[model samples]
Structure formats: C-alpha cells, structure tokens
Target: MKRPGIMIKDVFKRLTMKPVTSKYPAEKSPAEPGYRGKMEFYVDKCISCGMCAKDCPSFACVMEEIDGKKRPVFYLDKCMFCAQCEESCPKDAIKMTTEYELAHLAGNPQIVK
Candidate 1:
C-alpha cells in the first residue's frame, strides 16, 4: 500500500523528457577508426596460400579446393573481430575495413565468392 501521489509524479516527469535514442537508417552512424566490419578477400592478390588459414587465431578462416585451386572460406560467425587475419596475411590479400554496423533480422552475414 503505497501513496498514489508519488506514482503519478514519476509518470508525468518521464513523458516530458526528449527522446534519447538515435533514429537508425534515417540517421546513419559511422564506424570508428580501425573498426572491423565485413571481411573481403582479394582473389587476385591471394596466392591461394594456406598461410592465413593456418595463422587465424579463431579458426574463422579456412581454405577449400575449387577446380584444383585452394580458395579461402571465412565464416563471420566464428570470427572474433580481431585483426589477426589482416596482420598475419603476408600478401596483403586480406584487408580490414571499418564496417561496424552489420545487424540483420533474417539471415546472418554471408560472403559470396
């Protein structure tokens, strides 16, 4: 059994405040410097070498045989958002970009070859 006057005062003050949330989509946000978004592979620069796969800390990177050639297959789901893949990359084939926003309602992130 609490006082009704106290409850009414708290509710009235909440309605007077300005909205604190940002309008997403309508108001886009930029990624911070060095932020890692989606990972893109440079096929031409890639020598089909297994160096990146062997050195990946999270094991998110893998190589698959395709028409007698080994190509990289990366699963973003397992990726730890660390820049290890980019640093261990000798050929500079794997580069990191600032892509922080990657939310989806339906499917997870996919990189098509």
Candidate 2:
C-alpha cells in the first residue's frame, strides 16, 4: 500500500525530469536486433529477379514497369510483414528493418511502376 503510493509519486516526478526524446524524421533511433522497418529496394543489386514476388505467400508484392524498367512495387496494405521478401532476395537487396513508424498519407505503398 505505502510502496505503491511512493512508487506512483516517483513515476510522476520522473516523467517531468530530463527529457529522453529521439530526433525522429531527422534522426532515426536505434531499432531492435530484429526490427522490421519499411522494405528498401536496392535495384542496383537486384538482377530484375522475381524471387521475392514469387515467394510472397500473400502475393502482396508486385513488380511493375518504371520508364521501360521493371521494378518491384510492394503494397504495404496487403503485406503481412513476414520478411519473406527479404529472405527471398538472393542479392540481399531487400531487408526488414525495425522502424515501426511507417505512416504515409496515401495509406498504400505506391512503389510500383
């Protein structure tokens, strides 16, 4: 009973203490070891390979044409965040990073051509 009250007061005081904030958007914080952030497309490394698209269980990924060039367009809305795309990439062009803050105005990943 007494410890709970003391603990409550300590927590309140700590909340107003020195601020521990990370510079988001400008500076990214350290993600966990297995963090899954937005998937990055290293087209240079990619050999126009369709392994990631074919292996995706959800079929959420799409390879589209971009100015006569074929590129991968991933639909985040349909994605399951299973990291299958990353694993399927032989060139390691795609990876899952720990970036939980993936907010977009469109609500869809318009990476396709």
List model 2 lDDT by residue over 16-101, tens digit each.
89878867769877777877766777777877778888988888887887777776778876777898988988899887767667
Q: Which 10 residues in a row give candidate 1 its minimum summed lDDT?
A: 104-113
> If scored against the real structure, what TM-score would every candidate get?
0.69, 0.63
Q: Compare the candidates by TM-score and give the number of the best one.
A: 1
RMSD of each: 5.3, 4.6
Residue-wise C-alpha lDDT for candidate 1, range 12-86, written one tens digit per residue: 888897777878779987778767877778887878868878988888888988677797878777777777877
Give lDDT per model, in order. Answer: 0.76, 0.76
Candidate 1 regions off by >4 Å?
1-21, 105-109
Error of 2 at 53 (Å): 0.6
Instruction: Tell me the TM-score of model 1.
Output: 0.69
| Distance from true location, Cα of 13 in model 2, Å | 17
